[model samples]
Target: MAEVILFYFLMAFILIAALIAVETTDLLSAVICVGAIGFGCALFFLFLRAPDIAITQIVVEVLALVILIRVTISRNATFVTGDREFFASVVSVVILMMIFLMAVQVLNSLPAFGDAVFAEVTDSASKTYISQGMEKTGAANIVSAVILDFRAYDTLGEATVLFTSVIGAAVILRKRPRKLPEEPQI
Candidate 1:
């Protein structure tokens, strides 16, 4: 009951932050609101008992916030509200409502909380990881065994992707060197 209440409160907080991010004219304020939304999502993942996902979310959110804040601080803030802005806002709200409805429907179809749906499946990968992970990988922690030993290649690929993305963002955000004019010979 407390978990459910916390979940809804977090959801509301995330929704308000998202709306503030979209509606704010100040670039820095918008970026801060977006960071709030990301952190709220991390909290939601934690509430769901996914500590790994929550940690990843926090790392990604921090990186994103740093980049966004840097860009927002470096750039000149501008707002251009016109007649179409109202129309666009309405359309965006309608689309978001549709997506929310679809997500709710999907959530409704899922099994109840704390239900062990995978228990019946004897040959599932989760079962294998939970049962023989320590013996096979010689790791004390099951998560470490699965990530470092069982799915090492997959983890490596994910790390490579994250590293590449960070490099790409740095390259894109970096300031270009000013070109020097050549002197003409007499």
Candidate 2:
């Protein structure tokens, strides 16, 4: 019951933040609202018992927010003209509301927090991991065994992608040295 309440509260907070982000004219304010929405999503991941996902969400959100804020700070303000902007905002809001409704319905169909789910499958990979992970991998921790031994390539791929993305963002955001014009020859 408490979890459900918290989830609803977070959902409301995220929705409000999204609305503010879309409606605000100020770029900084809009960025801040978007950050709020990202953090709210991180909280949702935490509630879903996915700490790894929550941590990743937080890191990505912070990086994205920093990049967005920096871009907004470096760029000149441009006045938005015409009804097209308003129409686009309306369309975005409608889509967001539809997604929210669908998510709520899906959440309603899921089991409550801490509920036990009994799987009838006897020859599952998880079962094998639980039974023989430590013996095969020689790691004391099951998670370490699975990640380091069984899923090492997958983890390496994820790390490579993250590193590449960070480097790309850095390259894109870095300020280039201004070129000085040569003096006219005598």
Model 2 / residue 58 / CA error / Å: 2.7
lDDT of 2 by residue, 15-48 (tens): 9999998777777888999999999999999998
**Alpha carbon deviation, residue 83, candidate 2 (Å):** 5.9
Worst window of 10 by summed lDDT in candidate 2: 112-121
Stretches of model 2 off by over 4 angstroms after superposition: 78-146, 166-186
Clashes of each: 0, 0
Native-structure RMSD, model 2: 5.8
Tens digits of per-residue lDDT, candidate 1, 152-171, equal: 99999999998998899778
Pick the TM-score winner.
1
Flag clash pairs in model 1.
none
CA error at residue 50 for candidate 1, angstroms:
2.9
- Once model 1 is optimally superposed onto the true structure by TM-score, how far is the C-alpha of residue 82 displaced, in angstroms? 5.1
